[model samples]
Target: MTRLPASLLPEGLTAAVEEASGARVVAVRPRGGGGASRDGAELDLAWPDGRTASAYMNYDVHRAGAGDDASFLREAAVLRALSGPLALAGVRVAPYYASVPDQRALVCGLVAGCDRFGAITDPVQRDALAADFMAQLAALHRIDIAKQPIEGMGPIESADVFARRRIAGLRAGNSGRAWDPLIHLALDWLEANIPADMPPPAIVHGDAGPGNFLFEGDRVTALLDWELVHYGDPMADLAMLCLRMLFQGFVPLPQAFAAYEAAGGHSVDRARLRFWRLLFQTAFARRSRYDDPDAPPPPNLGMNLVYSTIHRRVLSQALAEAAGVALPPVAMPDAAPGAHDRSFAVALDDIRDTIVPRLSDQQAAVKAKGLARLIKWWRAIERYQPGFHAAERLEISAALRRDFPDHGAAWSAFCQAVSDGGIETEAAIILCNAHAAREAALLADSMGGLAETRLAPLD
Candidate 1:
């Protein structure tokens, strides 16, 4: 029997499970080492019939007192509703339940165990695994929201609303900071430029990634974690999956993209995916800036760079898609930026004197000052503009939008030069100091795992 601190287990959770399943609870053990393990215990149940059961016990952090119990019950209701339907497809989920009236705790049954990413190397295993994942994704999307029983969770009906809400959250985080003007501009454009009508709403697994899944030899045995699940566009799930996979540097793009397309995924609007990709990049960049320095590198780093690189590639691809004209690959560095220099200083100087000075006085003065200083030293150009080689990465990205028609062709052409160089570079170095890093990256074999793909960083 595995013993635990009484406070962590709460009161009667053990008895509740025993009563619900009619299993004799002989021992409770803790399971760890997975991506979704929270600050709680994993219970292992031993019965007289020589069988065993396991459950996940997690502490709720968003509510108070009995409110936590209510939250778990709500999730449980969703699980119950999805259970029968999912079982038909060879899928099952641990029953999500809450023990006691405390608003800060939850206890859920843990389903059959399986291997993690240890088995993703084999192709047959990979395809079967991808198929199973898609089936679960389809199952989630097929849920009838109207009949579901979660209360506080709102209906996600419109892509416009989703975009707006996301933008709003980003703006709120910006506050009166110096980056507001550029941030605000992007947010406004996204809000006004939403697709005419997105594919109808479906329940989405917001954080669909390899890390959150348990695979038994390429077969996804379980899709773990549901905190971010909600009713929304099916594309949202696809985007999340792509973003997660690409960020982790798992494999080739053609393979990943094709796998997704083969899995009954038909919605592939370039503009729609591009929008989410850009939004995901911008949001993640800001988040990285605010995260704890000691924490693991943000998953968004590679993605941010990929978006910027693609922005440039898109210009060429757009032309190719429309005219069958294959443009030269730009010589863009697949690396981060470098330290302060004349070009960077010049860009910052422009933002401070030209851009910041023209902003509305309604903004906070202190934020303006800080932003001015930050802008002066903003050697972060990978996400903003990734098409330029290290030699001029900062200048091109900073000027790409601002300079517009004047530098458009020249900028794009420059990116083509870099893209053709065929090299891998560090994301941070490319943004901070691309000029020096470009040559080295071109000679290097891997550029942030982008390979021969025309990749870039997102905004």
Candidate 2:
């Protein structure tokens, strides 16, 4: 929804588009849903003989230093490599046009479809579309990594190594900063249980899920968002797909799994899938923190908070499953009135009842709703956060057998205690469950009767 001003376009972009399309650039408009990591636009170009064409442009503006550049180039290379194979398989991937690494921009041919796949009403048609998506994923996994030799993708000895590398990178990313205890615990679990035997690595779409793809009716028009493409176990993509569906409510998980296997995906590995699910949810929860200086700012603070709350809850569920812990039901905290509580509530009502309805831009309206939810959350935080933190800190201190000034310090101490065998797994699981439950309760309080997905306890 955030449109790029005409003045913000780089001077050479027009020339680049002209050279690629053999036409003069006529106009450009920013596209919606560029996501937190990139900016996107559609360019209108005119040929010399009065013909015209359109192309998509993406700028990798969320550069987290060199790793980002490597990621961009790797995606570009993957797109280039997979173009022929994907087209042959009737999978619609946007054709690669040109990439300017210096400008951190890439242009590709526009594909026809929208990202709202869940809008399709016919259950049969939706199932067929889901099957087609699985078919495309199966085809992608069938790609011979050795024969392709994509630039920027290095070989790993095994999927286990690849998983470990990712964990290490996350740790490195969080170095010298206060760490989240839940993330540390998840990492420990993942490290302890890397699937010993696994299928050979295949090209994995690291971010494969509903929102990343486009569809028209029951058919998937294009599988978009290749920023996380890499060579890895295909289960990574499958796990990501199911995790996304779990949150989106687009398809039944068991049915989707059957379709995927029928379409030639590897046999279902429930344990490994669960492991990857925990990793995916934890990674996203950490991202919701928005603490990385190198990452781009979220579209708005409200959207970020909403994302954080939802993912944190999901992460909690995943952690509980992995740790074999039963989380107690989150009890609502007693609300204490603050001086600004009434004002915040009034502002939230105005945004929901007045401002959002009046907004002409659909995307702006959506953002307004998110802002309203954020204001409600702020009210809850004001009332409950201090008391909740105090209680949780006391619990963590008791578990660790040491006191700390805050949660972060206590978590660090607890992680060390676990590493040194001072704290047992069962004890850690209890503390983690309590911590997660309290956080989820705070988030639920913030919703103020708004409907949100409630994650079920692990079986």
Candidate 3:
């Protein structure tokens, strides 16, 4: 193995070419980020017969440690075993000696393929992309996992554990104050109704969706990004795919399901599909509340998924009552974006600038808790971070009270005082506290919020 320049590789990875193959590295390139992104690189290598070709490399940030090399080798082995039979396959990654000192980053070959997101706007392209995705999924599902134990993967067979883990991820990041009561109630409801049993699990690309693949015209040139691969019920993948579709607002629900089924996917029981769909959607709703940039553009150009989820619940209940069915507790709140993106943006900026700086001195352990992190963030907002203009914060707080009337009598009384045109200085101070309180509450309250009363329901 020849030593490559440290400057040639990313800050964390070690690079070398195989001497036996007469492969000599010649060049490198860089790429961008998306849903399941690994940074990209292009390697021009000279072969033994005086011929040269380029092999693309992708370095995933998640697999940055030495221990992960075996797991990655296993993933590459899975692809290598299956690539030959699939209708199309990106060149399966080749294992190379890793010199990565950090255990949180990775580097691998890049595949030159087109993105599907760019194609969704075009009709012919969308169909072709869907066909490619379905074909790839079917091929992946058909693989025989009974042979060697695929390392670093496990069976997520327990319904109780699955639900608990999902709920924990949500709660783990929450500040346990005003929002805790409602979030806990929702969790309790979900726990009581944990489906009795799930179907047999299969090898699933734990996080599968359109954005994770690459398209060459209508055909999938490569199935990119496999970090979350695991063994799970096939319906989990199916439900998540449909959820992505809905979030994209591409078509009617039944039509999307019909299209998927037509693309060679076995149609699971509709009820089961709906169960997984709602479960995945709720997880998404909670995760999106944290302001992730990559989440499918808010279903209707809207930012507040908490408001959206709650509004959906209200409608679901209203419809159930109309149909003479037992209406479950429509306790789901309106999960809408804050009345002004500006406020959230302002708050977030304060977190980045003022809050993070002061807390730079805090131990990383305290920084890990969501509430502690948020409180540290709020202290920054009140002092140096101008989360909301003084007058604006007051107005927003008053508005939040009306929008989330279920925030109980305490909040109602507080908002009532502000709504009555109180002093700007007093109102601003109160609103700042309320703003922090509400954010803390939302994290606790199942990570959602109410829709502003002024806006009509989205169609």
Best by TM-score: 2
Give the poorly placed runs of model 2, Cα more than 4 Å off. 1-5, 8-24, 47-51, 64-67, 102-104, 151-157, 287-296, 349-370, 401-422, 445-459
- lDDT-best of 2 and 3: 2
Clashing pairs in 2: none
lDDT of each: 0.48, 0.69, 0.44
Off by more than 4 A, model 3:
1-5, 16-25, 34-40, 45-109, 117-125, 147-152, 155-164, 168-186, 246-253, 278-459
Model 2 quality (TM-score): 0.84
TM-score of 3: 0.52
Error of 3 at 215 (Å): 1.8
Q: Give one digit per residue, the lDDT tens place, for model 2 in 1-459.
A: 234335546567656656755776666775543444555677666678987667787775445222366667777777776665445545568877677776567777788887776677788888998888888888788766666566555553467777888888766654445466567677888888888877888888878878878888777777887877767777888778866664454567677777888988788787777777777777776645355565565545555555555666677767777778876654445766777899998997899789977986544665677677677777777887777777777877877777889976776787677556678767776676666666656566554432356543222
For candidate 3, the clash count comes to 27
lDDT of 1 by residue, 364-436 (tens): 2323443443343244442223444333534554533333344445445444433343222222123223332
Task: Name model 1 segments beyond 4 Å from true.
Answer: 7-40, 45-52, 58-77, 84-91, 99-106, 113-115, 144-153, 176-189, 247-265, 288-459
Considering lDDT, where higher is better, how would the candidates rank from best to worst?
2, 1, 3
In each prediction, how many residue pairs overlap at the backbone (N, C-alpha, C within less than 3 A)? Answer: 52, 0, 27
